[model samples]
Target chain A: MKRSDYQTEYKTDLPVMVTPLPKTGGSFRFTLKPWHGFVILMACLVSSGIAYAVTDKENASIFEVLVRWMPLLLKGFIFNLVISTCAMAIGTAVGAALGLGQISLHGWVRKASWLITQFFRNSPWLVLLFFAMFLLPFEITIGGLTIPLPDWVKAIIGLSLPVMANVSEIVRGAVLSLPSGQWEAAESLAYTRRQTLWLVILPQCVKRMLPPWMNLYAILTMATVLASIVGVSEVMTLTGQALSAEGGQTYWHRFTPLFYYCFSFTATRFHGGRYIWKRNILLSTKHCLRGP
Target chain B: MTTNEEMPMVSIKDVHKSFGDLEVLKGVSMDINRGEVICIIGPSGSGKSTLIRCINALNDIQQGSILVEGQEVNDPNLDKLELRKKVGMVFQQYNLFPHKTALENIMMAPIRVLKQDKKEVEETARALIKKVRLEGKEDNYPGELSGGQQQRVAIARSLAMKPDVILFDEVTAALDPETVNEVLLTIKELAEEGMTCILVTHEMAFAREVADHIYFTDRGVIVEHGPPTTFFDEAKDPRTKEFLSQIL
Candidate 1:
């Protein structure tokens, strides 16, 4: 059917344009997506406002504060990056396994996966981090060899537990969202259950899984700061120490709002944040491939 | 069970199927002979589609025997995947693997299930694509193709298995009025090539033209069946005549 036919059949007011939009004759089309320019304005104003508030006679310029402290705080960011990357890797692996288990034919396996996912998903992240930090044996005796568990390793494990649960939910939701026709088609073709899941179902689920998985990664990235509570010396921990070392309570007014402004902008711009709030990317792909 | 014509290609004897308490197929039985094109026609609630699905064991009968080439379908020892390889099916919604191109969809089962060489199967797939009149469109994904093109590709995908029989369940019902004839033509070509075929269809005219045997079903039973000329033109049963008149 032609594009126009769809509009008529559905009784829709929106015109369906098959070809590209008519190009603006102007040489430069300085177009910003809806709220993008506003966000950039906000970020600049909010950041400079915080910097200006912290300024004093001794620290005459806000530029001096930034110049002095930016490098030191950035060094701590490497640790944040490390913890998040490690946790995400672990979470994705465990989550995928749990997700597959949730759909398993065996009753016990499905139940066990459900129990595990629910346990971590319900618990607060701070409580899990505390459990990791305090409950786990700091040292292990393996054939008279002492293996000390670092605080950062425990933090990563704690962060991953929640991430794993969330990612598994994403995987399960993605798999379930696929139409029953996909399974029936593969089954009719003589593909075994395992073969159908691996070859047909999971491949289709990847499109569904990606945006949420990326979203989960962003959440997990921010959550890495929680590791500082247990003295992991990540970005948040170092930022605190660096601020206090530079000054006392006065530095809080400077760096805290700076942190908030930077984080808000990062959260808004990242894959998990605004895009998920708008059109769900994976579902839209599905709609594009399979017409309404 | 010798190489005699007495034995049916697929024999579904007194098969019964139900979804919970609602019995979909009650004592349904039919014998599909080799090189025959059977078209099953009925109203919406009839067991026509269910019966066709049972032939390929897509739905298991609650009670009865379904033997394909004299092999019991529900035999515990029988590998269902192996059985299905020989019984190709085309669905109403052309369920082409959307990720794969048309040629890839056709080549997948033979290469994966039959363990055929990629080069050899690609040659056959290309030929089938050409036969479906989808030449130069082999590289297009299902999403890129029109409904008729997708259905034709689905037919080619089934034929790539070189199955003993092919089942088409309302293959053209989901298609446009203009595109219906294109999908019907592909099926007509298959029937002309002497491929054993069974179709559940709403298109009475096409069934009348192409079907060697026509089964008129109502509720969950095949009430009357005969050659298309006898069934469509001179239906014996009152229900068959009623169905014919309504559809015609």
Candidate 2:
């Protein structure tokens, strides 16, 4: 039946309830569920057991070696998390400003902001990281007091450069996507440009920006491994250390670190996936409830 | 320069407007008195919507002057915020903020921009919602309301400013056929209460019923204008007659 026919037949004052139709198409698709992390962890454990069984009887068990190094590996992984969190925070704040600048009424401000965004976005992350590491001073003297710069801090600064550019593009896209009628309506209501943007425009942009912003965070988390190359001693670098310290050329030792990295990244991605899934459900239900 | 009470609410003098080389309004002039309801009817692209948009300086005119309550609309030094407060507008699309409820949409500008007392503004907003026949749906967002309901909320939002003149630019154009009458009736009631209103509409019957003066515009200029009784019955311009025959 037609939607209008349903409305006419009901003839009620209550808000109409619309149930969204399920999507069609039967191609095989793989989506990460909340329980996928546990499955991956089990696979890693079973493989390590098989490796331990095949190894020479004189050496320590693979599980024993993995357990011994677990705490140190987790410490490095936690540091990676800290860097990712701080970089995302700084990037989002600065990127939001740069994005707003792209839409500025002044031609110079818009052009300069666009240039900065493009410059950082197109540059390689590793090149930017190397630049931050080499170009910055090891320590600075201010009023006879010295403050030292850490390697992880430098890595964060490098990673956040591209994050800021992507976020700026996201913000500009979200703002421009709104109907121009919104501006006209707000202007007709006597709101200043700043008030209209902050009050009407940005509030709506937040919903559109959230999913992509979270996706960026996940990609940045995986990119945290890049910091290992710069001597930040994150998970990847520590895994290399743990492998050599074990003093063995066994297959289990070689295969163990890969699982550690995979498991940690998967765990983080699982959390992000759950959040985005819940948000999509909320948004779809909202769309269904909205009137035609 | 005359006193506000004696002067026309809005006065346009030989206004000419263009968009990149295409002239949309050519030498259009009219005076709208206090408490008068004027409707400008024309074919598409006749500049009827453009004319009302200019009254509040939403669009700049290349030449000529538009004065709202004796204040120059096109003056470079003129405060548009203050002018907009005096001359409110309702658009065809009813661009209500999706984030705000109907009541909040009405109360927002007064509280935020004018810095009014929230308690008093809330009372006035509630009354306006009732006036627009949206009492039970005050908390509903614009997305939850029908097109007509959203348009009524738009009118109430404009009225909340208490402007000297209100402009409606095809306010009912986007409404469903079943809901158009509700919006028209609300506008008609506002006209009956002697509010000064200028409208650009295709609703000839409603224009005849409510308007004190009717203007027929064609090709960027007013072809004919008079009271609805005579303008519709005795149109002198061939363009006006042909336009009326096609629509009516």
Candidate 3:
């Protein structure tokens, strides 16, 4: 087809450009609506009420046991957050470089990056966690300085491998999605290839990359639970320990751990959702800056 | 030694370009003089755009040479950034950086590539933006502007480099009919200001009015070329006549 005809067809098929509405003070506020908060409160109340009614009269009430164990379980949950944050930080830093390597001008770099990304991305997350746990040395000596590697540190490394691969894919996909006209325009203006990629191409890629990157973070946060199997004392492991300590016979007591898990997961997701929404507004405002 | 004015600004000699199996330009040759306005008119697949693109080394030719001033453009060791700095191009899509305001788009290359002082570049950018007759739209993003306004910004962007010659590759081909005149008027003003311009266009009337020389091509070769008055009015090749008849 003629280039003009192809361009016209592409332009018509483009999703109508949405001019963002004027930002009022309230619009930029937190995304968790009052209804969401109410629903969470109701679920907590109903679950606790059910647990309180069914427990043996002589034994401690499910609510009382929960109150006793809440501090320990909260500590474990905080550890989970730490694991997720560290894993995500390491993954993003390594993954961005790997992703750029996939598009590098050197054939060897591109092929090697592709192989590494595919190898880690396709392997099961649980397997990678085990591999990190078993294969990595327990301690390393660097110039007379010894650093001990803890199980939780190994779990962070294990979880980061897959996150890195997935993030690599996200970066590569976002870069490729941009129109070729951007590169050509930059080239005609005498910009070097490196200058074009940094200034013109990558800045545009950030908006396209943001949503998927956030999605990967959410998945990585959930995957941190898998570290429990590899011997990290994360929330799942602590919950299992707490259940055994409370005398594992009662049916009513079993629901307490489920309740704790649900609450923690929901809390993380709510915060994640809010964060993604706010970043979207900030990026769009930077790029679009709605004119009068 | 030849004087600077005597040397052609851009010279092409027996250039042959191909895309894998298909040959687009078959030994095409042309010489564009300093301060001259040359318009290339042809059917869709006639290699008009490809030829102009070759002048800036945007497309590589399989055979023969292209020179900007006295320097060979196709040399492997040639600094393309240097070549591109001297020869600017405006595309059909008006590929303005959507992330930047109109003023920033005009100012970017001079500041980033040329490493000019930001204040001086900003001054020149504002002047170029005003030259394109887009005064109040300086702060508007490319997405917020009409197609004509965006194209004008694109023109101003290329002009910011202060290139010795500029190539317009069917720049108005993608615009609405109402907006086409605004873009064409911008080009006409640039031509009147004696900017050496080589345009590939379908606008016959505008070509007749502004072009110092007109080249008609068909089947990957220039069928005829001459002063616009003779090229358009006098008897010429049957293909040129046929192409002109269909368009005009």
Candidate 4:
């Protein structure tokens, strides 16, 4: 037996040989190595722990502060949850309409929709929140009916203004990014313009529309702090009050994905803001990746 | 069988189309008969593709009416989608949906457009896959296939809709040398089986072999049109002869 080489039945001076094999799919093939994966995982965890420990030594940890005031933290966390859910629902519905309107064939409709998105997106969210709370009527009468738009309405309007822009851009780009032929292809299949938008175009666009959706949600949580100036007893307002009482050197708004959910009434009640924020961030990431 | 023997299947009268200040088609007129394979050969920008697209209501004509199967294609009140259902189109790029699997792409138009039963569409889809000689590759995406295979899938997807007339907008211009024969042969077989096709093609040999009617266009006008035999063998237009000589 030869150790170096195999003896062939036929030898030829040719460029190639024919081989029948199954076709491979995709740009490149990947293989799983469990041992390598485990090593990488352990290394990542060890490095992250060392990094966090160093960060804690330099500053007083908010995690520890929230742990000390667990009861009040829980209260604030609930307020944070309410603002995000309400704001996101309002933003998505309004944004989808604006995005579709901007692309509408009608000249006036397209122009009107484009103007609204541009104005809201460029203006500061905090400024808009101030206007909604301060300038809007106390008891507006419409058709002999008296109703209050409420201070909470200001919070949602502020949060939704920017978030709607984000959602509108996402939806518009998703709709436009679809191939020009999808419209023609749908037409050839006997799908009406409205039916194509609902069935073919929107369904196809949703899969590509999810990742950016999370960023808009994260921004909505941060924007809720604007409610504090409006006398809304939301989480941020309560947290500011706690810091003012504690005689802390200074408190900067922590944008670590979540905050406390405090209920806003005439009297404010605090909850464990830390725990709720953590859950919100975790749930949001999962929802965004796994889809609605 | 389209029962419009007295009236032409597709009728275009005094058609004019423009872009900005430039006119692409200038007062063109033609009638496409029922169950006919017509080859439209011309110089670039002759508005051949646009003409067919207007027939399907994909492009709007500026100053004329286009009728498909004896119905007005350009009526503002007419359901453009329903009008398009009877007119299939094949592009130079073979615009198959990249996100869908091959079988799913072929099945979508039939199920969505015709509202056919899922089982029936699937059966027809399988038959189409077989007809295009793409067995064991139903699950593959269009992006995974070669240019030839993608074009074939585009062909099959249009076939699934069962359009009255299929418009070929230079479908084989994007294929490679060896693969061109495979696609042209498939088209030849279609012509033999009585598919009413309007082929906008660069391959003169395929046009000579399969076209019942041939129209040689030059700068948005039909310079000459007749039976394939006279049109190719003894072309009266000097521009067509000059064009054919450069390619051949």
Per-candidate TM equals: 0.87, 0.90, 0.88, 0.76
Top candidate on TM-score is 2
- Alpha-carbon error at A137 in model 3, in Å? 1.0
Q: What is the lDDT, from 0 to 100, of the residue A281 in candidate 4?
A: 23
User: What is the per-residue lDDT of model 4 for residues B1-248, given as tens digits with 9 covering 90 to 100?
Assistant: 35568888888888888877878788888888878999999988888888888888777878887888878866788777777778888888887765678998899877876889999999999999889888988988776788888888888998888888899889999998778887787788888888889999988888988999998888888889988889877887888888878876
Tens digits of per-residue lDDT for model 1 on A1-292? 5656656666675545343233557757664364764575566656765756766536546556656777867777777878888998998999999988999999999999999999999999999989888988888889989988899989988888998898889889988998888888888888889888887888778777876777777677778888988998877887788667766434434453444345544654564433442332244454554534
The CAPRI classification for model 2 reads as medium
In the predicted model 2, the residue pairs found to clash are: none
Name the candidate, 1 or 2, with the larger lDDT value: 2
Model 4, range A1-292, lDDT digits (tens) per residue? 2311222322332434322232347647454444554554455444544544655345445445545554675566567668777888898999989989889989999999899999888888888778677777776898999987778876776678777877888899999998887777667666777877886688667655765676566557666767877788776676677666544423323321223211121012122332343232233334333411
**All-Cα superposition RMSD per candidate:** 5.0, 4.3, 6.2, 10.0
Q: Stretches of candidate 2 above 4 Å error? A: A1-31, A48-57, A143-145, A247-285, A288-292
Question: What tens-digit string does per-residue lDDT give for candidate 2 at A1-292?
Answer: 5655666666643564543234348856586774775676677677767766777557677777878888887888889888888999999999999999999999999999999999998998888888888998888789999988899989898889889999999999999999998999889889999999999899878777876887788788878888989999998888788767776434434444454456556655555434553332234445544645
- Which ten-residue region of model 1 chain A has the weakest summed lDDT? A273-282
**Candidate 4 docking class:** acceptable
lDDT of 1: 0.82
Best by DockQ: 2
- Which rank order by TM-score, best down to worst? 2, 3, 1, 4
Put down candidate 3 lDDT per residue, A1-292, tens digits, no spaces: 4544644645653445433234656655556654665576567667766665675556676668878888887788778889988999999999999999999999999999999999999999999999999999999899999999999999999999999998899889988998998998999898998999998988788777776877777777778889889889988787788778876534333433454446545655565434553333244544454342
